[model samples]
Target chain A: MSTEVEIKSFIVRNFAPDVPPDQLEPDLNLLDSGVVDSLGLLRLIAWVGERFDIAVEEADISPDNFRSVDAIAAFVADARRNSEVAR
Target chain B: MRWNDDQQALHDAITELGDLLSENRAERDAAAVFPRANWDRVRATGLLGLPFPDRWGGLDQDLLTTMYVLEGLGHSCRDSGLSFSVSTHMVSVGVPLLRFGSAALKERYLPKVCDGSAIGAHAITEPDNGSDIMGMRTTAVRDGDEYVLTGGKTFVSNAPVADLFVVYARTGKAGSPNAITAFLVERDTPGLSVGTPIGKMGLRTSPFSEVSLDGCRVPATNRIGGEGAGFLVLDHVMKWEILCSFIINVGEMQHRLERCVEYATTREQFGQPIGSYQSVSNRIVDMKIAVETSRKWLYDTADKLQRGENVTTDIAIAKLTASEGNVSSALAAVQIFGGYGYTTEYGIEQGLRDAVGGTIYSGTSDVQRQRIARMLGI
Candidate 1:
């Protein structure tokens, strides 16, 4: 699956337990809606770190980056591009 | 933090220093001194090495053993500031280094930390924000093999006297939780200046201050974990901080309970002792429950954390329970002591003062509740 699909699946799996992954909004404001919290935010970043093989910089742990599935996908793409550049 | 006989002996040995500390506590509290003598006495007992590995001159004890011994310190030592300082000195640098530092970093720094020769502290909270750490303004920019840091950190527990600091600075874009990074910055590093100690209402003996990084240049090799692992490093330290720091609060509550009981039974009022009155007696009963309840949540959550279960919620509850419980128990002690409690001569007032900080530090009770609320998916 694509990064966006996979991330949406994670959101559905962890937060929208009763809803299917495809049903979860790709542009949902996870932070404003209380779908994720500070601790949940940390856990989500950690998951991103592990799943994407991108080490999360503390500065990168912002609500904007992980605001929604599209944002997460964008973050992953940027992180991958940055890592590749470093390589 | 389980303890064997050896740990028990260590606990007893450290507890004896309580008499030494209690002697000049009021004087030190009045002066707001760091109690260097008490610090040396604690160092002599080898208590500083409790949680470190034998290879690094540590006792190689587990989390529970460390908590058990620290709780003993809280029970015996009347100076809450000293206990707070000791816990900070242990977890501030040792924890991050032991967990995230490279072998070279550990080899060079862990021994000094374990020996107490090099005091350790971590810098995270900013003047603009206390709990909203991700919003801190400190920045670290990469420049070849070094990162030039610029920002200020306030309310640092051991910053005034710390020989080294685990400084957290933003290396990535703002609003990104993982954008910050941890760096081990030496006290003597040029452009890094520690402000004079700032006074406080409680934990006064443990001085805090602001640390300024004005174009402070630290080698990139000084970075801890990966470039963005500061949050993980801090999260790990906070878990240990809540477990170890508030466990001491539990000890203080226990000691306060016993002292209140002794005073209640012996100090007669009217035709009988104050203990005879349900109003007075009920308060003591509640204090007992508070102490036990704090202990239960502490160890139970610790056990879960040790088993590798996600205690993000459990720890918040435990921290909230222990911290707020300490304040509740201390207030009761003061009320039970009546006039004596209000007087500094009896030191009962200090108990309340010390307990107040428990609720504020290590993440406020309100913040803990928020964490629990978040875990509840609300």
Candidate 2:
């Protein structure tokens, strides 16, 4: 699956289980829509780290990076790129 | 991780202060009084500034090293309340401000926090909202260059003697993740009043009270993080709080375990050492297990946090294990010591009392379990 697809699936399965994964918009503004609460955000970050094998630093934990599916996918890609470059 | 000579030296220095800090602990605990002199002594040692930058009068120690030193404090100091207050002062205000406060805020307040000249506390739990921080009714409205805060916080550790507080109040819609905001409110701020210290079951010498913020005006620059970032700020602080505070408990448990072992081996029953009996020895064995388990969870979680990984579940599990383990270990020590442990003179009863507060504060055991369940997608 693509990064966006997997992120959407995970978000839907964990946060908005009732909604079909495909129905969840990529730019839905999860924070403003209340799709994810405080605890939910932490869980999402943990899942992102484990699923993508990325270390989400404290500085990367801004609302911009986790506002929606597209942003999270972009963050995962960027973190992976950075990790590779550092290696 | 192996500690270098400098880290070892720092840890030893704090451990050496145990004698002075533990002096008159029983009397202080009995009176439920904060040990002002001991606090001053701790301030003098620069132990309070562990894990902070040296530019701000800290030792520039890492998280693991900080925990290591705190473990020493716990093992050597008999006054659990004073130790509790020490951890509270560090993680409550210093940890959050250092991480999230603006450069101006850091420059203005970090020095005081590091030097221990100004004690720190945080106001998060309200009478109506303990576990559910999102449901907090305290509100902060933006007014010109200041934010007007109106709310009340309860069970605020170090409140009675705290010079600074990281107060979380709602800045947006109720129950929204982005609703709450953190403010660096001073104790002397107008309309901010701290109630008299309330009595507690354990950690009695720590001193906690209710904090009321009635139309308190705080400069916008005093905000710790961006608007609506209170949850994130608190998340970071709670991670530090659980690790830093519970590592002390780990040290205390180790000490309790040693004392139990000495008693079991030395105290004779029916002309034989009590430790020779399986019943008595089994409890001591469990205490050992609890100490090691709590230590492992605390350090492992701290290591993970320092690596900047997401530790939402790991932290919750660590907190649950350490807090519950400390409680059980204390009870087991009391049991192993028998009547002597029950007596106030031995101070074993005080250990059990102090351990109970670990489960209640920093999120109750039930709350930790619930957090784990949520992380598990339940």
Each model's TM-score, in the order given?
A: 0.87, 0.96
Cα displacement (angstroms), candidate 1, residue B153, comes to 0.8
* DockQ of the candidate models in sequence: 0.13, 0.55
Alpha carbon lDDT of each predicted model:
0.85, 0.89
- Per-residue error at A57 for model 1, in Å? 19
Best by DockQ: 2
Against the native chain B, what TM-score does each candidate's chain B reach? 0.98, 0.99
- Measured over all alpha carbons after superposition, the RMSD of each candidate to the real structure, in angstroms, is 5.8, 1.8
Per-residue lDDT for A61 in model 1?
35
List model 1 lDDT by residue over B35-142, tens digit each.
887888888888898999989999998888888899999999999998998999899899889888899999999999998998888899899978887788999999
Could you tell me how far off, in angstroms, the CA of residue B101 lies in candidate 2 after the best superposition? 1.1
